[model samples]
Target: MNTRQIIIIALLIIALVIPGSSLLGEKEYPKFLEEPWDHSPITVYIDEQNTPPHYSPSYQPTVIRALQYWEKGGNGKLSYNPVFELANTSDADIYIMWVENMEEVTGAEEGVAGFCRPMIANGRYVHADIVLEVGDYKGYSWQQYGDDNMEQLVTHELGHALGLGHSNDIRDIMYPTYEQRENLNPLLVQTTYPLIVISILIAIGISGYLGVGWLRYHKRRKRLENELLKEMK
Candidate 1:
């Protein structure tokens, strides 16, 4: 009816036209295979010989801890259980190796934390090799970064080996950068939780508004019918 009212109606129409989910910056986790591993144990071998001398036997425990973290922290969504083994390189399904430089695995000169290369056959991931560049954090002692940070790094590479691509969300373990945090942020862990709750509330409110409008329309119609009958009488 007026300029302000017309502007409000136009804004409402625009809001209706836009997709609500698009407001949130959520992206899909790039998957490696169509179906995930059905809770089967994936044999992992920590390459003792090939690992850098500075990160030898001491780093082995870190790798084992990292594997354990994956199994317990994945919340069953990871699908595969990581089984650490003393098998030879050829017998193992997954290999974890440490490298002084990641320029070979990743084409970067610096700050390349780790890399995962998965072998695929018949559209299924067969095996994977993970390489962690300890030299990335040169000055930091193994004790300093080894405990929590190393576990996080291995978890990230293992995520890729399990057929997940890097997530844009830094809070996710699948993120390209290896954050030195103890655990993943809450948002990445449950991206849709808030969205789902908001959607339900909006749905309830819309239903209530529609119900009130229907009742008002019915009451007005009944009142008009009675008035018409009285006039006729």
Candidate 2:
């Protein structure tokens, strides 16, 4: 092909490639996807002493709201009390604690924002511990995980506590990574799969159109050359 035609083809290919790369997302697998909790309205005990950074009386309610987010997200499969009972008993269903660092959660753990460890007995869940990190670290501004970020993380951990698994879809609150969504504690998921499908179809249609046009152009050019040669002959 001529230089101009080659340049145009290269530009189209690059434009298609970059967007597909961005659309490609990491597929994270869930570690603890067991059976659903056997009971409804599971009990949760919060360690009030190790509260989120900049603790205030109002923070507890926000945390409760985070728990309730699951109730709505559960869609009748699971539920938690709107009111968090006081931790008078040691055997609460779920225990949420805030640690100063990942090291406290696990001796050598680093770079993780939080994690959920489930207690299993006789192939069933007994309890779960969910820890959130709020401690300051040098060169790590991770302590700043606040607002929707922290609340969403809370819901995600609760999902684990309920024997749920991580979601490959980033729009899901149960996604492994900490993603900031437009809406906090989403009950309905808007997926990109449909968009991806539509884009592929459009790209294919475009390519087919371009190919047909190129063939027609060559055919027309050959016809013109043949007619010119006939006249000369």
Candidate 3:
């Protein structure tokens, strides 16, 4: 309404602008293939490799959890039937495997997590396999995330296998670059949490500084008015 109020509002808005503004430009919303999965609740099988330097007891469970997270996290956009836990058969719409070797694979770069290769037929994705990096790679460690990047790896590849392309959005699960996301919500892990806190702190600091100035101005104005009144008397 007034100049001081407008300044405060502008400062607060600027403080909060970083989170949403970063998502603007180029507009690659829902980057996807020509065809989506032809069926509901796509089935997935994990080819668990239980060998030294490649296997952990947590691997299988973590894979299953990633599958389940897909079913729940996407707000009904995805459904997964994890068949690997029940049987050894890798017969499913999607197959997930762990590997330490990357020399032969296409996109398994050093420090890379994994990659997805989908088989398409009749303009539809028929089958796909996700190869995940196991153990440490290029001296980099997986000390973060409860599942240790496994969940994000599977989830990202699953998005591709389901006919979705990599998202430009940093907070998206299908973001091309692999960022350390300890939380299921990528926003919190990627950009939202610390930035949001910083913005709030900035807004508070600005308000406090302005408030102090306004209080000083008010005191000075009141004292000057009393002096004027005394002079008039």
Best by lDDT: 1
lDDT of 1 by residue, 89-167 (tens): 6557788888765654456545567777767666565777887876554556332245567777888887766655556
Model 3's TM-score against the true structure: 0.53
Clashing residue pairs, backbone N/CA/C < 3 A, model 3: none
Q: Best by TM-score, which number? A: 1
Clashing pairs in 1: 32-163
Query: For each candidate, how many residue pairs have backbone atoms clashing (under 3 Å)?
Result: 1, 0, 0
lDDT of 3: 0.56
Order of models, best TM-score first: 1, 3, 2
RMSD of every candidate to native, in Å, equals 17.1, 16.7, 17.0
Give model 1's TM-score versus the native structure.
0.55
- Please, what are the lDDT tens digits per residue for candidate 2 over residues 1-233? 57887677667667766665445332223323235355655678778765655444444565687876765554233323333344645578788887656565555344566667777666556788887765436584545555566676677777767655556666767777742221221111112333344345445545564676555555555665564444333
Shift in Å, residue 226, candidate 1:
68
